[model samples]
Target: MRDRVTEAVPELVAAAVAAPSMHNAQPWRFVHHTESGVLSLYGDPDRTLPVGDPEHRGLHLGCGAGLFNLRVAAAHRGWDAVAETFPDRRDPWRLADVMLEESGTGPSDRALADLFPAVENRHTSRAPFTDEQIPPEIFDELCAAALLEGARLAVPSGWHADDLVDLVHDAELHEAASDLMQAEIIAWTRTGRAGEGPETEGVPAYAFGPRQHDVKVPVRDFGLPRNTERRATATFEERPQLAVLGTEADTPADWLRAGQAMERILLEATRDGLATSMMSQPLEWPELRSMARDPASGLGFVHMVFRLGYGPAAAATPRRPVADVLTVV
Candidate 1:
């Protein structure tokens, strides 16, 4: 059974690495033990954003998203995956341990297999969305998707939406002024990494979408410092549709759960004909993060802010090769 599943490790990791990360950093590494029939996921400190993500929250979230993809990919290949996060407290780097056991009860997770296609198709669209409201049923479905992953998806309205945007604006202001944060953005962004260089990671110039001239929700201008891209300014929606994925507690585990829920929501949204992007700016600031969630309810910690609507797909950012991020035993 181990030998059979060992052959699938490369392709499974291939799909897993396709998961989205902050600035396309791809901050994760995997070590699969063929003998034990298990895969261990570790956070790559070298690839992490220290200043921007000092707590390594974002890194954990990215790895969690990758873990979700791995599960989906394995399910699609007819493997039963049992995952345990934070298996060893002493080894903090070991974020998760996933056992790929041969399915005795036949292929499990056929439902998750249905989502395998969306894993690759989903991209963060920074472009303007058409001002069309999603059907009530689809909106409810999106919320349900979050619930499935032990998270809450709050779709703010009226003043709440405005307040969230204000929080984002405040977060953006802080990021711009902070030299450390700016440096991380600079390191990850490129002139044309996708088309040019042998660069396998980081967001490329083309994926920057456009300079948001007038948009309700905030879209980070990754090319603001360069000014060389000559990217055009585009008009976004008056009140852009936004959703917040939150957790009951603010911890590494919550962040991991949020990341998985986030990917589930993004893929479902894409399948429903919605373009999506994530804004973690406000969440970065401890002061502003509380305000990011619904002020009235104050239910959970805002882990990620999502922009969802109809728009062109953002260009695919480069991902690290499977070999670089995964080690097979």
Candidate 2:
């Protein structure tokens, strides 16, 4: 078992790091204990976004997404991964402890293994989507995907949707006025030409997509700062399809679960031939986040807002090498 785990750690970590993070920071690390066959997931403190995610909620969510991908990779390799969140209270950085066992397949294992292909294929699309309505069945599948990870997916419509859009705009105005937030975004966004430098992490200029001609959705303009390169403009969908992912309680463990759910929904959307992007701007502001939730949905705390529809797939973002984020014992 140890030998098998040793051979699989690299591939697993590779898929894990492929999971999306705030500004593509990729704030996650993996450590494998060969003797005990235990794989540990940690939050990379150095990669944190202090201004954008001061409370580290987004950090834990990113790490949780990585953890979900690790499980998918293990299932694809025919290994059963039993995972526990916050295994050590003394070490807050140690987010999860996973025990890899060689066991026979089960229904849930097969279900997770099915999403393995999407683990690498999924990319956050920032381009404009056409004004096409998603089928109700597809939304149902996405909701089930969130529920599988112990979270709720709510589709806000009518006046609620309009209110949510207003909240997103409010958050955008706040970001525009704050210099610290802008600096944080600039720090994580690279404007250099490809191959000019290592540029392994951070959202590259190529992935910024065309600038929105109108602000119908909550897409962060990474090119907002002065002196940044200008991008082509395109009109985005007027009524952007949005969904809210939430959990019953707001805690570290719930944040991690929400992250897992968020990734699962993204992968499922990718598999279904849909383009997806995230809107965390409103959620970043505590005051706006409270108002972002739908009063009719009966959800407690909303963790993420996702935009889904048919559009061009996004360019793949860069990721740090496995050696930079993994250690073996």
Candidate 3:
């Protein structure tokens, strides 16, 4: 059993690293206790976006997404992964500990195992999506997905959705005016020519998608003044189908749960043949994040805003090699 667990560590970490992160930072580390059959997750302090994610909320979210992917990958490999978050208070960087138990009968989480196919297929679609309505039933499935991970998915409509879009616009303007924020974005974005060689992390120029002709939707603009000629212009959905993923409290654990929920929704959306992109612009600022939630909905803190529709598949972002992030003992 111990040997089996050790052998599965590489494949598991590879799937976990495939998860989305802020600017593709991939801010996570994994360690396998070969003797105990335990896999541990840690947040890499160096990979954090200090300016954009000052409180480490986004960092926790990214790690949580990786955790969820780890769970799914384990399930696919016929192991029941029991995860505990923030296992050690003394080590703040230690995020979660997952004990891999062999499933004697079958996969413990068939639902999670079913999502393994979508794990590799899921990519953040920054490109424009067609203006078509997603069925209400699909929204229900997504909401259930979030709830399963201890979070809520709220679909904002009418004036509420419009208000969220305005908040994103406000955040964009705020980012534009703040030199520190702009510098942080530029640092994580690659705008080099084709022959410049590939980056192992960060959003490359090809994945930036086209610049929106209008501000109908809140797609982030990563293009700097130096790369103006490289980006093409296109129109995005006028009234994008937006949903907010939130939790009752804003703590590290809550952030982690929200991250897991967010990834679950993204994977489920991918399975349903929908294109998806996330908007954290508004949620990055405290005031804007507060304004993002619906008072009537009773959601305390908003973590991420999702734009979902039918659009072209997005270009895959780069991820660090597994050898750099995993350790075994």
Better of 1 and 2 by TM-score: 2
What is candidate 2's CA lDDT for residue 229? 49
Instruction: Compose the digit string of candidate 1's lDDT tens values, residues 1-329.
Output: 78877888889898888889988889899999978888998989888888778888899889988988898888887777789999999998898999986554443377678789998898888888899987878879889988888888888888988888888889888988998888778788878534433468777778887888764568877887566557888888888888888888988899888888888888788888899989988888888988887856555788888888888767777887788888877
lDDT of 2 by residue, 1-329 (tens): 78878898999999999999998898898898888888999998988989889999999899989999998999999988889889999999999999988858679899899999898889998899999999999999999999999999999899888888888889989999999998888778888845333489888887887888887776777777634546889999999898999999999999999999999999999999899999899989988899988878989999999989999978889999999999998
Error of 1 at 153 (Å): 0.9
How many clashes in each structure? 0, 0, 0
What does the lDDT read for residue 206 in candidate 3? 88
All candidates' TM-scores?
A: 0.94, 0.97, 0.96
Candidate 3 lDDT:
0.90
By lDDT, the best candidate is 3
Query: What does each candidate score in C-alpha RMSD?
Result: 2.3, 1.7, 1.9
lDDT of each: 0.83, 0.90, 0.90
The ten-residue window of minimal lDDT in model 2 covers 189-198
Full-model lDDT, candidate 2: 0.90
lDDT of 3 by residue, 144-255 (tens): 9999999999999988999999998999889988899988887788777554333998888888888888857878877853356757889988789999999999999999
Residue-level error in angstroms, candidate 2, position 227: 4.9
